[model samples]
Target: MTLAALAEQVGVAVVNLSVMKNDRARAVRFSTLTALCDALDCTPGDLFSVVDP
Candidate 1:
């Protein structure tokens, strides 16, 4: 699915989803994360990784 479609499914703004997609997001809400996971049908572990900063 496209970013716009994912954003619509997750009930979040495209800009916000874009920020997460681009790794520019400083934070994410649990509810939003849940929505994303539900839409994508994946676990949180699948969506995130420990980045060596």
Candidate 2:
């Protein structure tokens, strides 16, 4: 799905979603993550990775 469509589904602005998509966001609210997970039919573990830095 397009980012615009996903944004609408997740009740977030396209620009904000774009920021998150581009890894520019320093943080994300749990509500927003839950919304995304619900919309995408996935879990947080599916969306994020803990990399060794």
Candidate 3:
């Protein structure tokens, strides 16, 4: 899904979504995480993967 579309659906900025995509997001509220998962038709694990940072 397009970041723009997701941002619009979640009422957030595209740049913020980009930050999350880049794994530079400092924090994410549970509500936002839930919304993201629902919008993307994915689980939280799909939105964020664990790896060496």
Candidate 4:
């Protein structure tokens, strides 16, 4: 999915998405996660997955 498009749909700036993509974000709000899920037709699990370190 195009983050720019998703950002547009979710009323968030592309830079914010970029930061999230690069793992530079300190945190993400539940509401933002919900908006992303709703806009992308996906779940939080799809957006992020736990991996063994």
Q: Taking the candidates one at a time, how many backbone clashes does each contain?
A: 0, 0, 0, 0
Sorted by TM-score (best first), the order is: 1, 2, 3, 4
Listed in order, each prediction's TM-score against the native is: 0.94, 0.91, 0.83, 0.81
User: Between 2 and 3, whose TM-score is larger?
Assistant: 2
Q: Write the per-residue lDDT of candidate 4 for residues 1-53, one digit (tens) a residue.
A: 79889899998999999998897887899989999999989899998866687
In model 2, state the lDDT of residue 44: 94
Tens digits of per-residue lDDT, candidate 3, 1-53, equal 69999998987899989998887899998988888888878899887777885
Candidate 2, poorest ten consecutive residues by summed lDDT:
44-53
- CA lDDT of every candidate: 0.94, 0.94, 0.87, 0.90
lDDT of 4 at 53: 72
Q: Whole-model lDDT for model 4 versus the true structure?
A: 0.90
| 2 versus 3: better lDDT goes to | 2
TM-score of 3: 0.83
Candidate 3 lDDT at 44 equals: 90
For model 2, residues 1-53, the per-residue Cα lDDT tens digits are: 99999999999999999898887888999999999999999999998888887
In candidate 1, residue 28 scores what lDDT? 94
In candidate 4, position 7 carries an lDDT of 94
Model 2, residue 7: C-alpha shift (Å): 0.4
Candidate 1 residue-wise lDDT, 1-53, digit = tens: 99999999999999999999899999999999999999999999998899787
